[model samples]
Target chain A: MEIDLQGIVVIVGNYGSGKTEVSINLAVNKKRAGVDVKIADLDLVNPYFRTREARSQLSEIGIGVALPPEEYLQADLPILSPVVAGLIKNPVELTIIDAGGDDAGATVLATLADAFNGKSVHMLQVVNPLRPFTGTVKGCLKMRNEIETASKMTINGIIGNSNLIDETRPEDIYSGYEFVKLLSQESGLALKFITVPSNLMTEIDVSRFSCPVLQIKRQLVPPWKKAVKLS
Target chain B: MGKVLMKGNEAIGEAAIRAGCLNYFAYPITPQSEVAEYLSRRMPEVNGNFLQGESEVAVSYMIFGASAAGERVFTTSSSPGISLMSEAISYIAAAQCPAVFVNIMRGGPGLGGILPSQADYLQATKGIGHGDCRLLVMAPAGVQEAVEMVMMAFPLAEKYRNPVIILGDGLIGQMMEPVEFPDHLKSEPSNKDDWAINGMDTRKSTERNLVKSLFLDPTQLNDNNLILKAKYERMKKEEIRYEKYNTDSDYKVLIVSYGTMSRVCKTAIDQLKEEGIEVGLIRPQTLFPFPEAAVRETALKEGCKAVISIEMSMGQMVEDVSMSLQGKLPVSWYGKCGGDIPTPEEVIDAVKGLNV
Candidate 1:
């Protein structure tokens, strides 16, 4: 099944909930599918393991990456590049904004309220049950409210991104899907999609889930791994 | 609980709790503030105490106070925060209090960038504080090892009745990995009655317990230093831990690296072997004990021509590498400290350039 992700997608989630990974993979997936894709890295809360780490990789594949200026690339300041607002305003086939973790990180989006005004925005909350605050349905709902309030945007969808990194089992994916399904029912938000690592794609029976499955290539790895160098 | 993917900083906070350390005092710093964040929510669940001190200086003394009261206590901080805590760390050592300090090191010397760096090698191992003070330092390569080391640190600190340091780089604190905490490592605080100022009634001893770092008498101070010196000496004998990789092969270069840098070197070694070049590695799990005999023996291997200390620092660990070799072989340094970790290919190129 194809992912119907288009028109100003803002990915927000709790800390360590795989928001950056989901944002990167979603951009790549849409780009390869012949859509004009651009992504912005607004992760000022974290100084490491950010979407900009994969900037060159995205650019090599003909996807535009909008982040801070070169001088402030490594700085943990909440400085938004003009290109981000420009990208959102002009409206590409698919524009993904990888917001930072939690309400604190999402606060940056409120500053861009003028750019996001009157836009058809799909603010999706990437939920990883394995993380701390987003573990339970109540916790996930609480995070949704906090992120929505902080970003000045409502979370219209949920993205199930549950895995234990390299140790992810097929059962984990199935259970994670069920957890998000319950979350969708409780919160009245559509389950936009669920993510399965590219390595575990074949191992998992994708037919079991009715939602679109976004196969995640494990970016944002530790530096020891063969990683994409920061540009 | 089953294994879960967790950032190293969060896992460390949980590991301390699992290890029965219920008291946590810390000040927030990048790449490691997640530890304090995790504990702030978690400590309340377990009815444990978690306090964010006004500053790292105050936090270290809070650790000292809790540890002196016979409570298992620990703190996490970045490079500059650790510098502020150094004064109290020395006092804790002098007073013989068991406390754990986790330094998720960022680039350093001053307020360096928040990216990963191992430049705190000299600071952690040699000059943590004033006087002839030394801390037992353990370096973990990844999240799993980080969890295991944090769990082991409490017991080890109490065993020596001194402070222990878990030296990790920013990558270790920032990255997520699947970790399963060992159930057996959970332990209760032991031997606190002998020295801790818990309570006179609790100990039921006629004499009250006293905790003080100041022995104003010159002879008394000398005796205290001697006692500390003897403890460090005993640590060298009983606590030296290291791992040797590809040593049995006729490797030409011996790389002494630790923490995350060692993992990069390991990958380089594998790639070099594929290209018909043999390179061995000595990774020090414990930085303090230095693993001198291990390095000396590994470097003495017949075909090993030279040694290199590959680290994120300019050349801090190279001194220990040279001292370990005792001038038996040439030693060099190869690394980057400006927050960029050397890639495995770069490490392979460095190894190939040795021209052994």
Candidate 2:
């Protein structure tokens, strides 16, 4: 379960598979681990619930967030910030690129292939078994092939981030772990880690998981809730 | 079959399929484009038809065609796209064909940002298209409600032979929530044999059924409008849906809101109760058959100081609130437009200002 928490890590997944949540928590975890972390918001597909929504919170913690220019920040057009290319070319202790959802969202990564050529990138496919299209092993494999073909980058590992938001139970995490374990066996990709909501961490037994357990403090919430303050 | 986590857009697409709506025609627009994206793959699996029309104008006509043929059909689009579809909406409404339209609203008078906004309140409730046209409009507060409303819309549209609208904002279409497709809501399209153009051979009738909105004679046009008026009146008698929160208490401020904005008001109401400031909320689930009587009665409750319309629009629903009150009580408005939803704290501030 010793994941190499270094180099450029690109996170990809199906739409609504909690990719942005995993990306944000991973960057925060790496930052607390005393590593210089800078994350890029490369999501151009979804108009809402992207990494840029957490820009102020992430910036408060000294984690650099690269996003599209001010005018194009809210636009859905596929405009990648030049700073993303710069982040990919230069190396920090940990650089995370949060790609958009599905093959359509991941297609933007193919445009940055030149920047990622020389670096050792760990492209992890985040699988939330509760989400549509990735609920089965066959569906997970199909998504893997599509994402790999679309991004022109091979996935090296899997990040299990299964939950039904507030309705998630302990069995969901255990069953999600088992589901992703089966996916790793079928796809021959390593299981890097599994995520549990920080509130539910006490209910879950981490020893059941063979990989490291990443506690996710839910950041991307509905507008009505108090703004997430990640200390 | 079982409960699963899904985005509102995907849940709406599945709900239509479960409701036996086999035909879906749409032009992609955010943040509701996922409905088209989801149905494109799902429709074929169920032996249904999914078509991406060239534009919203074309898609709206496609809905008209399928509905006239006595088939269950629907389309999903955002603000500007719905504006494009309004012409056909008028045609379908006048033709008395059953059709369902889901407008996952984005901010706009024209081409506004693709963030969540309830700015289309007036457009949907009062003036959707030209002429005397009214749609049975339902608004949902969350994803599960969106699914239920989408499922109910088809049957309601057929029941009255008029177009039905599901009015949601971008957040309702984009946010993720766990939803269950109730087995009871799975329904077959009601018998459309009476007036549908289902071909002479199919109906086993020698006469052809003509479906058209044109009434060249002035008297005939007036009769047509009368029939439409009767259906709208029946809807007002039966379909005025609203949820009252904290109204049991002697509240000072009565807040009228709908869609996602209402959820924020609910949170503000709960927080205000803890601080000893009483605020009540009326969340209208149906926008067209607005809960007028309920709002008026609640606004006249004991210790009620004033009524405020809280929305994501620039005071669109306030007019409806004013109309409902009929000048019996003072009505005011507070909101933000172009995608910055008022947070619970901001809503609390607004409510406290009313108290002061």
Candidate 3:
């Protein structure tokens, strides 16, 4: 069930596809499984939800997290931190870069053409059928083209992140898995992983999934929901 | 354990891993991209972290994050990329976050050509970013030094809680040579629970941990700045390191250079010596916390009347030489900018023109 993934694993998805969430969960899961994991917060276009936002949690779990300098934390200024150079030199297990949504967000990787020289990087586009891009085959291809052209690094895999937040059902998971399987075949992207609601894991036929299944837990719960869960 | 033939850029990458810098972030820049490409696969074997960031600007910040958590972290870039990283390096310096950075220096103020050049001398030594910040600049003269200096950078950074810059021009980065890695220097993880912003662990202090660059009050910032300056001054007394060649003899000209340029100077000096032209060289191993006393003493010595500062930039370090000489000896300058490397024969010609 585990591939010796010691190189760069880029996580890409549309705005609400939960790419960062998947990245965070994957990093923790790998690190807990005795892998030396480091997460690069490459999600520059979006600020609200970034892999770095869970710095404290990642650090606590023995996962190294490289974030852009604190000055760029909240600033919308377009500058990749020098830490990327460091990351390229870093010798760690499972370096997951949380890239922004679509081509606009992914285009930033073009600046790093030098580092990608002679190296094969896996850029996985996360898909959610509930989202506009995932509802049709053409929409998925359009998103993939945008990301590939923007990143300047090819998209080698597809991550199916089907969910309805806390309301995810087992049937919905089966439907989503099928939709992504078709998308993966059409787009020629290897079906990398499928994400499932942690509570519904017992309901689904976990053994049926050919690739790994990651459990998604919202790192950032809204204040209203936090109070309800707090009790 | 054995001397392996490796490129300088790859050596630096391996040395950082040996130094226990398991966490790294960076964006790719020309001439130094091999460092990133090498680590991408090596990190996985070691179970380390390697990430190509959105830009050099964000990569430096990522170093800040990893280092702030008390883990050994590092980043690398070139001239334009380093320019983007200056802002974060300043913050790392001020916060006293022990981080390592390698600048495989290339040419220019803009999109300089991708040739070997040491055009970033002033930026490396004179604090590229704002405020009274300083970095420990270690200049590697060749591939071997590049590997050794990186191994040394980790402990030095941790001990001082400061950022260390490995200044090697593109020549060293591109050149391949045999490097013997020190077996004893494989670094271990440091427990910075006292200062690191690790989430509230009761094993240490419960105070709020903040890693920010802002200090609103001028006086408070000024007072801290003064302390930092004092630290730099103390560093001069302890960390100022350089290599002296043929200074025992009454040499007519003294060549001053660092990084790959210094190696070139050494070659030129050897060539001049073979030709019966009495000359010497002062190769600065540490650019910042410079070997000021050595320069002053060497300049003051009788018969060593002229000093020439040769570099890949338009003589950025020449200003420092001017300050070091201070009329005691006539200090001149010569350089090749925009990625062009000066030949040993050209340096000899420049030396003849200086007429020490």
Candidate 4:
């Protein structure tokens, strides 16, 4: 199944909304599908479970990755590499900027507004109904406005990714789809897709989804859980 | 009983709410911002008041006001932010108000990096504010312990009518762990008939209550200080908390540590045990009440030759260890600061360097 994600997909969400995990799996999925993919770790607020943590695997798979300088890579300062500007200007078939969570994190994306002007930039607000601010339609819409105001970019789509880490189930995806559907109709943002664990796909009815399903391979686990490579 | 994975900051917030503390005032600072964010949505649902004050300084006063009015209240901040609230902490201590302050400490001298550090040890236990005041400080080693400590902080604060601090490092704030808030720790709210400024109308009494730290007369101020000192002595006598591991058996050295650093020491001790070096640990769950007697007795244990204090700060807790031992035993120190957490192997090397 070809998920039609293309051209500078910027994923923004509240913290713990699973935006980073979604960004990693989306990059891997499109890369495996033979598209030239590049993921830029622009998250400067959160210090853990970022796209850069999967740099070794992403680079090993020939997916282009842009990160901070070698010395400042692990640091949480808001230092954006110059190459990120070049990537946004030149454009790849699929470029995923896994932005930091919350409006505080999305403020960094405003620096690239000029480079993304008139370009095919799909600023998608990833929503998890399980999280605090995005659990209701009103909260999600308030966050949508905040992200757009902070980034100086409009959100064109919503990606429902309601989950409870390892405790997530098939019903969560279905329930989240309904929640985000009403959110989409209320906010006028397209319902891009809802994510389902690849292992739970056999148990989920694909025909129930109106939009394409992004098969998520869990890559971000707590330190106690055994780490698994998505690819 | 049942366990749920939670971030330390969120867990502390939930623990406070579960402990009947409905008023929360805080300003966001990493890595403890999640606590404020969690309570913003949660407080209203539980009929609690959650406010993001203009600054840590303002929030500290907000806590003082709410707590003075006989409501259970708390606030959380990081290192520099805690430093900003130190003045208010001192005043709250002086006025004998019941409030809890949580410091999910990060690296600091100034606006230090946002990583785990125990650098606030001296600031917390020794010199939190101007004049003379000491907080009942507790350091939790894990998420579950943090929850339990936060729950205990309220009752302990009301028990003595003083400010209590839950000192945690960034690791405890950022890491996710399975935690269960004990059912027994959910305590009834303490009554405040004598001192709380809950207004005469609310209490339906003719007598007005004053909750101020100021005293014009020098003799009155001295008497207040003596009263506060007596309470400290009582706390030291009744509330000293520490855990001993491997101290029952003969050991060459005793390791003194607290908070997340203690867990690292436990692992290092296990590794040392495998190498035939018997090492024990004295983890002080409470920092202010200092567990001095426990340290002295552990140091006096037969076959214990030396004591080493392990911390993330540069030799802060070691002074307390030396004070506890009272020069009876030789004391050494191992520490790292500025967001650098010492590894288990590094701890092992330090233990070996002690050489009994």
DockQ scores of all models, one per candidate: 0.71, 0.82, 0.01, 0.14
- Which lDDT value does model 4 have at B196? 84
Taking the tens digit of each residue's C-alpha lDDT, what string does model 3 give over B111-173?
Answer: 766677888888888967888898889999877788889888988887777888998887777
Per-prediction TM-score: 0.96, 0.98, 0.60, 0.80
Candidate 1 local Cα displacement, residue A219, angstroms: 2.3
Q: Which ten residues in a row have the lowest lDDT in candidate 4 chain A?
A: A220-229
lDDT of 4 by residue, B252-343 (tens): 89999999888888888887888888899999999998999899999889889999999999999999999989999999999999776788
> What tens-digit string does per-residue lDDT give for candidate 1 at A10-49?
9999888999989988888888889998899988898888
Query: What TM-score against the true chain A does chain A of each candidate get?
Result: 0.96, 0.97, 0.92, 0.96
Q: Give the TM-score of candidate 4.
A: 0.80
TM-score of chain A of 2: 0.97
User: What are the lDDT figures for the candidates, one per model?
Assistant: 0.90, 0.91, 0.77, 0.86
What shift in Å separates residue A27 of candidate 1 from its native position after superposition?
0.9
Tell me, per candidate, how large a share of the native contacts it keeps. 0.69, 0.78, 0.00, 0.02
lDDT (tens digit, per residue) of candidate 1 on B1-356: 77888899999999999899999999998879999878988999999999999999999999999999999999999999999999999999999999999999999779989899999999999999998779999999989999999999999999999999999999889888888888855556768886788778867567878899999999999999999999999999999999999888999999999998998898889888989999999999999979999999999999889999999989998999999999989999999998999999989888888888
| Highest DockQ against the true fold, candidate | 2
User: Number of the top candidate by TM-score?
Assistant: 2
- Tell me model 4's lDDT, rounded to 2 decimals: 0.86
Candidate 1 Cα outliers beyond 4 Å, as residue runs? A227-231, B184-188
Taking the tens digit of each residue's C-alpha lDDT, what string does model 2 give over B57-78? 9999999999888899999999
Model 2: per-residue Cα lDDT at residue B35: 96
